[model samples]
Target chain A: MRIICCVKHVPDTNAQIQLAANKKDIAREAISYVMSPYDEFAVEEALRIREKNPGTTVAVITLGPERVDQVLRTGLAMGADEAIHILDPDSSITDPLIVARCLAQVIKSGGYDIVFCGRQAVDNDAFQVGSAIATMLNVAGMTLAGKVEVDANAKKVKVERIVEGGTRQIISGSFPVLITAQKGLNEPRFASLPGIMKAKSKPVTKKNAAELGVDLNTKMIIELLEVPVYQRKKRVIQAGEDGKSAVKQLIELLRTEAKVLE
Target chain B: MNILIVAEVSQGKVKRASLEVLTRAREISAGGEIAVALAGAYSADAEKTLARFGAGKVFYTDHDQVSRQNPEAVFELAKMCAAECKAGLILLGASFLGKEVAARLSAQLGAPLANDCIEIKTAGNGVVVQRPMYAGKVIATVQLGGAQNIVSIRPNSCVAKESPAEAQAKKISLDSVSLKTSVESLEIAPLKRPELTEADIVVSGGRGMKGPENYNVIEALADKLGAAVGASRAAVDAGWRPHSDQVGQTGKVVSPKLYIACGISGAVQHFAGMGSSKCIVAINKDAEAPVFKKCDYGIVGDLFQIVPLLTQELSNSRD
Candidate 1:
């Protein structure tokens, strides 16, 4: 069985986010990049599946500039067989649909039985890519999957997905499905020294839009990327001149500022 | 053009979120009639209650197969109803079920959907939706374009509106289609009286709470104030609390009115979830804890000493 996990390099979630000087996007220069939190679960789950059924291959695919090699290496370290990078060095793209179309083209040509991605990229916060990819390929898709079990022989899989205040277990016809994993689905393993060495030797192929029969040209582009306006920081409203005064001030802030009155 | 509000019924009662949707929908659409599509086996009381929310017409599809949770069937019925009514905008709650239904419906209809929107307003370009990203750390204003724009409102984002529009609550029978998946057997969790997501006040513990046994102080304070219980990533990882109760970048994002953090050093990941709370109270022995920077109020004392006294005070005041 062949599985492909689509991963994206995003700013570390732990980074101190500051608005860019131009206020178009978050300050990315000083921040470190890592695989998306949700995709970590996807990659980890893929590794678990391969472990359960030997002879299964898990390939990690990412689209970004050469700097994203670190992200691909991170996946390789996590036990993926190989990595593929779709280099877009300029980082000009902003639309998720175009990205999904390109990925669908590659997935179709690669003959992957299953494809996985994080539910949404933390940076763009667009959840459309995976669903759009599924639509483009005309296959079953599930998002925010908590638990997944594959029956390779039956071409069916059972998924427990989050729904309104609860979870619903649904089964879908498999062997051409897209799924997005949420965090807490699995713990990603650290790469060992030997595995890290092997990752460097593994195949790290590159595919451009032209090679994938996808037009990289875009009509609508982001005129600007700006950091959203941050609300003013909370002032330390000194409560009455006692230990209990602070508690009263806190309650007032909740009622007046936050408006979460209990 | 009519704004079709999708009514969700659970065990024959209208979910409160639907009313909130109608209220928000009422504010956005320009004098458009609010119609509802009730697509499950529902009681008559539900129909009347839905009509109270300014729904001039309620189109219901009741069938045995769709009485429970069935996304495919719900989508089929919704598609038929939406086409028949010529809905310009489709609204659903951004809950677990709503996300699936909205995703399927948007894909089926080939419409651009904005999911988990905290607010919706008409923009010069189109409808602008403000949705919280990175667990409310960032809010994005989105411009959606399609013949029909589908918007899913986040749970607890909007207040329930009470607009007295005396409209007829008519029930229409609809057909049910076969679903690809069926529930074999289901196990339901007992409902906890207080859920962290909907709690007005939340008192959370972290690694500094010391141990699992020390969590009693946090729980006692929450009980006194009728607040929900929350935990930091450290406490959750140490198995001091269920993961569901963890609040941080990796856990549930909540916007309670008041967030009281005890012994939490306020890692950025932990703050991402609860940073949006209106007022924050940090109780830790360390005066330089990171949580202090984000908190509106701080008590540089042992939480063990502070929490019990606060709980007793609240209990006494309530009595």
Candidate 2:
């Protein structure tokens, strides 16, 4: 069995985001980057699947510049057998389709049975690449998988995905499919000292978009970027000794001043 | 230019989000023909409803594939409709099925896509879309740079208005093609509360709620206000609420008319999910909690006391 998890290096969730001077992108400097949280779940799930079935090889793939090597090494420490880096010349590409196409071009030659991608990248918040990859490869695309059950012998798997309004769709499909990871899929483990040392010796293959025959043109262009402005009243009614009066005043304001309530 | 609005019908009722997209489409269509694809089993009232929302043509299908809300099926149907209508742009609500289908359709057609758009407009010969990135902390105005465009809009981003017009209804045929992956069963949660994304008003709890069982107070307030229940990431990680209820950068982003934060400190991530709401109210015991600084109204009091009292007041004042 062969599995590949596509990971991305994004700004940490806790980092304060600010627009760059260009106003079309965020400030890249002074921001710490980590593996996207959902991608952590994908890599963790891939490792768990490899553990359940012997002779399974788990590999991690990423498309970025030199900085992406950190995420790939972390994936190696998490028990992936190898790493594939498609040296992306443009990290500022806002178009998810080109990313999907570049990754698909490489995965097509890898002969992997299953592919894992995060539900959405936290940085761009675009939930397109995972399914777009599936489309590009013409693979059975299952998204937002909160729970996965694989039957390697039958070459099939069953997935329970959470949709809106709290509905869970139980779906079963054959191997050679794409699964987008959702939260609660699994708890990712930290790399131990020995694993980190071992990862240093693992093979890290690097390729570029030109060699892969992938196009680098962007379709969606960011015209402008700005910090979101909020017109919050920031009004605080002190409860004082009379909490009820404060509650009454707030309710009245909601009904009349803000007119949020009838 | 021709535009196709894909509508989702659940149990003979059109998804309100779809109508919202159609309404937005009617606004920015710019003298272009607006068509609708109401594939699978839907009601006549739905067809009429589409016409009332400025759909000049309604194309529907009952193929075995499209009835299940499967991504592959809907993608096929939409691809066909785009060609039939000669659509230069396609719009779908960013619902569970809509997002997946829109993604695939855009990739297959090689159209530039703008997903989760809050606003879209036609400027000169090109189209412009505005969306939030970095979890709504940064807003991006993007330009679509292709012959065709695919846009999936967020629910409740636009309000549906009636603009009755004559709609030429027709039926389209699709083959029974499955993606080799099929749903065995659907387990719908019994909770009938409004979905967080679609609700006009939202009431959310956080670590201040303390325990899972204490959500009843929050739920009581939500029930009275008829708002969806939301939870901050802190509450979800502690297993006090389901992941679907989580509202933050890692969770669902909501834009409701009224957002009541019960015992939730206004972290940037949490605010990113719902900072666009029209009104925000916070109730917490801590005077210095960050929520007060970011809310339209704040009451420095115990949620245990304030929530129930607010619920009682709302119930008494109900129309």
Candidate 3:
């Protein structure tokens, strides 16, 4: 079995984001980058599948500027057999269509049985690329998958999708399918010392948009970016004297001022 | 510049978020027709509700494949409707189903999409929208730069208004599109409380709750206040709660009217999901927890003592 996991390099969730002087883009100088959290789950799931199915090959792929090679290395150290890096600095400003197009081009030629990606990228939060890629490739795709079971012999996969209203939908598709990882899928593993050393020598095949024949034109453009203003008027309820008083005061505020309770 | 709004139905009625999208579409129509596309099972009553919300034209389909909510089939039907209507802009609620359909439609139609938009407006012949980035820390103003644009509006961002108007409802038939995916089964967990995202009030617990058994205190408070139960990532990671109940960047983004945090330290990720709540109340023993600074009300006390007392007080008041 050949499994491919798509990963992305994004600013750490805890990074302090500051707008650049132009105010159109985030300042990148002082920010630390990490593999997107959801993608970690994707990689972990792929590794687990490979472990169960002996002789399965797991490969990681990412599309970004040269800095994204660091993320691919992390995937390699996490036990991926190989890595593919689609290097395009201009990708930073492109839309999901272009990104999906490039990934589709690569995956179409990679001969993978299944594809995995983070449910959404944190930077844009578009949550579209995975499904878009599936559409472009004309493959079955499922988003927000919390659990997956593969019957390789039947050439079928079943997934439980996280839906609204605290409900889940069970979906099944054939091989050559795409799945997006949601939280609670699996816990990712950290690289050991030896794994890190081995990853340094792992082959990373680099390509660009021109070579991949992907159009870089974007249909959406950022006009402005700014920090959002908080509209809430925070009125702290003083403890007054003791815990009992604080509870009483809070209840009063909820009933009267907030009017949330009848 | 005809506008098309995809109306979603849950149970038997139209979703509130879809109604909000219809309302927003009416504002951006610029005197053009505001059309609504309804898929799956719907009723005359649902059509009447859409008409009252200013749907000038209603195009509906009850195709067998679409009833399954297959994104491919749904996208095909929506794309065909948009083509027939010559829709210049398509609007949908940024829901799980909506996002999936919009993404595929954008690719098939070669249209640009802006997802999870909070604000959308008409700029001459084009449309501009604002959406949160970096987990709501920054809002980016995006301009749709194509002949046609597809947008998914975030839930709870816009208010739905009733504007009765002369509307026509037409049922359209679409040819079945063979899809690679199929639904094996759907299991909806019996909900005892409101869904976290749609709940008006939410009571969340964090690691300070100690263990899974200790969550009973949080549940007691939630029961008294008639609020949904939520959990911080720390609590979910500790196996005290399910991921579905998690409220944070990695979890579900909620915008309840009142969000009460119990024993939570208010990590940045957690704040990202609930920052849009109308009112925030933080209850923790640590007076200096980051949540205190952001919350509308802060209480420095042991949750074990404070929560039960608050629940009792609320129950007494109700009686």
Candidate 4:
């Protein structure tokens, strides 16, 4: 059995985000980058499935600048058999569909039975790419899968989705199923010294859109990004001798300014 | 202008988030038709509750396929209802189900969808929605490009307002013959006492809580105040708590009336999850803890000593 996990290199969520002086985009001068937090679940799950079912291969694919190779290496260190980097070093694309198109090309020819992605990238927080890819591929897809069980013998898959207010479980008929893993799907293992050494020797394949018959120059345009205005910054109304007095003042602000309370 | 709400019901029960959406819809678009597109196997009790919350017309789709939580099926049904009612705006709760369904529905209907919105208002030419970006550090006003505006409001962001309107709804059922997916299995989490996001008061612990067994302080205080137990990413990563209880950028985003931090030196990601809370009370031995900056009240003392006293005082006051 073969599983393909889709991952992305994003700005390290732990870093402080500063709006560019132009207010159009995020300033990227000194920001560090890493694999998205949710994708960690997907990558870890793929590794475990390969380990549990000996003779299975796991492949990690990502679309981003050349720096994305670092995330691929991280996955290789964790246990992936191969890594595919669809390098668009010019920083030209931002649309989820474009990302999905690149993935669809890889999935169509890669001969993988299953595909996985983190529910959503914390950077964009759009939650659209996986489902969009499923739509493009015309295959069964499940988002926010809390648990998954593969029936290798019967060629079927059962997945439980974490929905609002409750959960929904669904089973798919065959391979080519796309799923997004939720947190707690598996405990992502730390890279060992031997594994890191072996990762350096693993094959890291670079495929551009033109090489894959996709237009790398095609870009999705985004309007200027703006941050919300905050007149008050880090000013907490410390509790005085009477806590009730502080609460009263807070109520007044909520009523008049925030207008959230009645 | 008309406000349309997708009345989300599962297994014949109306979700609290749907009621919360109705309240928000009313606040944004004052006194509109408030039409509700009700799908799934809704019971009679659920229909009446939908009407009680100012739903002028309840377009019911009682198809078995609609009963399943498939985004394509639900979006098809919602699109038909929106067209039938000629609604100017459609509001859905930005829960896990709502986000995907709303996105596909908007795509199919050629309408713009503003996702996980905290606020929505009728702006000139369209509706302007406010959503938190960059993990709650900044809010952005997202504009949808279409004739009819569609938005998914984030759950737990708005409280349900009760202004009972007496309007008997017209139920309409659709053909359920062509369905895409089927529910195969279900494994429910053991019903814990409190849902993390719904709790009015939340008492969260961190690595400073010491060990998994020492989480008793959080549980005790949470129990006394009828609150839910939460944990920081550090605690969850350390295997001291379940990932389900983790609150941070990767974890659940929550806003409660009161949030108490025990032994937690707040990280930016952790604060992003619960920073918008009504009142924050921090307890840490380190006076220089970052949590003190975001907290409304701070106690510079050991959580081991202060938690017990606070739990006892709260329990006594409740009695």
Candidate 5:
């Protein structure tokens, strides 16, 4: 069995995000990058599948600049057999379709049985790449998957995905499918010292977007970026000079001002 | 230019989010024809409801295979509708279904897409949109470059209004596209409470709630206010609540009218999910909790006392 996990190096969720002088993209400097949180779940799930299927090989792929090699090494430490990094300086400006196309090229050439990716990149917040790749490849795809059950012998997989209104949809699809990881899917394993040391010598292949036949042109242009403005008048209630009376004032306010109550 | 709005129907009624997308489409039509596509099992009542919302033409498809929340089926139908109507702009609500359909359609048609857009407008024979990134910390204004544009409007940002225009209804049945994926079953939790995303008011608890059994206090508050129940990641991780009740970066993003946080310390991840709420009220025992700074109202008190008191007050005032 062969599995491919697509990962991304994004600014840590806790990192402070700043915009470039042009306001078209984020200022990359001074920000720490890590494997996107959901991607950790994807890599962990891939490793678990490899463990279950003795002969399975899991390869992790990333599309980014040279700095992203660090994340690939992290994936290697997490037990992926190899890493493929598609080096594209213009990666930040490209749209999700371009990224999906680049990944489709590699996945098709590798002839992998299944593919995994995080539900969305925390940076762009565009939950499109995995499904776009599936559409481009004409394969089955499931996003926001919370649970996965693979039947390698039957060439099918069952997935329970999170839907709107807190509903779960159990979906089944054939092999050569794509699944996007969601939270609570699985607990990711931590890399041990020995594993980290071993990952230093693992093979990390690099390719350019042009080499993969992916067009560098994008279908959208970012015109401007700005910090979100809050219009609410954050009026903190003065608790009527005491805690007990404050509750009374709050209820009266809710009834008269907010009108949420009564 | 022709514009097509993909309407989502649930339980034989058009979803408010989808209607909001139609409203947005009407506002940006700029003398162009506005059409709406309704897939899945829809009633004539739904079509009439959509028509009243200014749908010039209603394209619909109803079949067992297409009615099971199948993205491929809906994508095919949307693509066909776009092509048939010669639409230059395709709009849908950025709900689960809308995101799936727009993503697939954008890839198959090679169109530019902007997902979860808070604002979209006609820009000189093209379209420009604004969407939040970095978990609602920043907003990006983007210009779609392709001849065809697909956009998913964020829920609760756009309001649906009645225009009461007559619509010409059209039913389309296309050749079946091979579907490699099928929904086997849907296990929906039977909660009489309002859905978190759709609710006007949300009452959320956090680690301070202490235990799973203590959630009853939060539930009581929510029940009194007719609000949905939510929990922070800390509470969910502690197994005090189900994953579905979680509201954070990894959980559901909600923009309710009123958000009352109980015992939550106000982590950035939790704020990212509910930052867009219209009104925020934070109640915590810690006076210096981060939530106090961001909320519209703050009460530094024990949730155990405050919650029940608030619930009792609300219930008493209802009479």
Candidate 6:
């Protein structure tokens, strides 16, 4: 089995984001980057499938500036056999259409049986690239999978899709399937010291946009970047060393001030 | 510009998110026609609701293929409807089905897509949209290029207002079928309160709640207040609640009208999820919990004592 997991390098989830001087993009200098937390689940699942079924090869792919190569290495250290870096050094491309095209182009020629992507990237939060790639490749996509049972011999897969509204929809399908991993899919493992040492020796294949002949004109561009304006009243009622009085003040405020409670 | 709104239907009525998109559609339509490709179980009442919500034209389908939200079917429907109206822009409610269909359409149409957008407007010949980044810390204003754009608006971000357009409703006819996947079954757990993302009021618990069995206090308050039950990542990771009930950066981002955080210390990631809420009330024993600083109201007392008292007092006050 040949499994490919697409991962993204994004700013650390805890990083404090501020707009750049132009106010059209995030200030990147001081921020540290890491593999998006959701993508870690995909990479781990890919490795687990490889472990259970011998002769399976797992490859990790990412599209971004050269800095994104680190995430591919992270995936490699976590147990992927190879890495494919679509080097967008300038990070000029922000369009999902272009990114999907570049990714689908590579995955289509690889003859991979399965592909995995995080439910969404923490940075843009578009969560569209994987499905778009599936559409471009014309394959069955089981998105937002919380649990996946793969029948390698039968070429079938059963997925528990996490649909909102507190429902889990069961989707049963065959191979050549695309799966997007959510948080609860599995616990992503940390790369060990020996694994990190071995990852440095693994092959990292670099590909670029021009080589793929994708249309360079980005379809989506950031117009402005700003902090969200908040109007929170930020009031903390005096508890007066007890519970009853504070409860009274809160209920009063909800009625007269917030108007949320009748 | 000619715009198409792909509306999702649940339990017969058009979903609130769909109607909310219609309200946004009326604004960006710019005198051009605004239409809706109302998918799933189609009804005249839904059609009328669409009309009153400013749908100038309504194209509907009741094909069993869309009975359980087959993404391919929904995508094909949206594609044909977009072609039918020559839509310059398309909008969806950013629901699960909506995002799925929109992504496929983006690939099929070779157009840019902005998903889960909060604010949308028209600038020049194209559209500009604002969406959250890093959960909600930074807002990115995006411009969708080309003559066509596909955008999905976040739920509860826009108000659904009545515009009362003359309806030109039609039965949708597809040129071909591309259904492949089948749903074995869709099990909806019996829910007593609303889901985290869609709820109007949410009462959430954190590590301070202590254990799974102790969540009853959280649930009790939630039941009395008519709100959804939510949990912080700490509680979820500690196995105190289901992942579906988590509200934070890793969990569902919520914008309920009122979010009551009980026993939660207000981690940054947790606050980022519910920070956009209209009103926030935190109840934690720790006075210096970060949640208190960000909330509209705070009560520094043990949730075990505070929550139950608040529930009874609220009911009595209302009576």
Can you tell me the DockQ of model 5?
Answer: 0.64
lDDT of 6 at B119: 91
Error of 3 at A12 (Å): 1.1
For candidate 4, lDDT tens digit of each residue in A116-231? Answer: 89988887776766766665565667777777788777766777665532444564445667788888787778778888899999998888855677643322223446654322
lDDT of 5 at B199: 86
Model 2, B128-215: lDDT tens digits are: 9998888898888999867889888999988899899899988887754556677776666775799999999999999999999999
Summarize candidate 5's per-residue lDDT along A9-32 as a digit string, tens digits.
988876767789999888988998
In candidate 1, what are the lDDT values of residues B1-319, reduced to their tens digit?
4677777787677877778898888787688777887756667887788767777777776555356555555666677777867888888876555655676676666676777777788764347677766666666666775678778887668688787676665555444344544443333455543667767789999989878998888888887778888999899888888666788876777777778899999898888788777678888878778877777767777777777867765665557
Model 2 residue runs over 4 Å out of place are: A90-92, B176-178
Task: Report the lDDT tens digits of candidate 5 across residue range B238-283.
Answer: 8888788898777778889899999999898888889888788998
Question: Model 6: clashing residue pairs?
Answer: none
lDDT of 4 by residue, B1-319 (tens): 6877887786677778888998887776666678887756667877788777767777776665566656656666787788888888888887766777775655444455667778777767577777776667666666664677678887778788776776556655556434334466543445454567666778899978989999988898787677788999999989898777888888877778777788899898898788777777787878788987777666666677677766665454446
Error of 5 at B213 (Å): 1.4
lDDT of each: 0.73, 0.88, 0.86, 0.73, 0.85, 0.87
User: Candidate 6, residues A144-181: lDDT per residue as tens digits?
Assistant: 88998989999888888768776667777777989899
Query: What does the interface RMSD come to for each candidate?
Result: 4.2, 1.2, 1.8, 5.1, 2.1, 1.5
Top candidate (lDDT): 2
**TM-score per candidate:** 0.87, 0.97, 0.95, 0.83, 0.96, 0.96
- Writing each residue's lDDT as its tens digit, candidate 2 over A21-94 gives 88877899999998899999999999999999999999999998888899999999988999999886676555
RMSD of each: 3.7, 1.5, 2.0, 4.9, 1.9, 1.7
Best by DockQ: 2
- Give DockQ per model, in order: 0.31, 0.81, 0.68, 0.25, 0.64, 0.74
List clashing residue pairs in candidate 2: none
Share of true Cα-Cα contacts across chains kept by each model: 0.16, 0.83, 0.71, 0.23, 0.65, 0.79
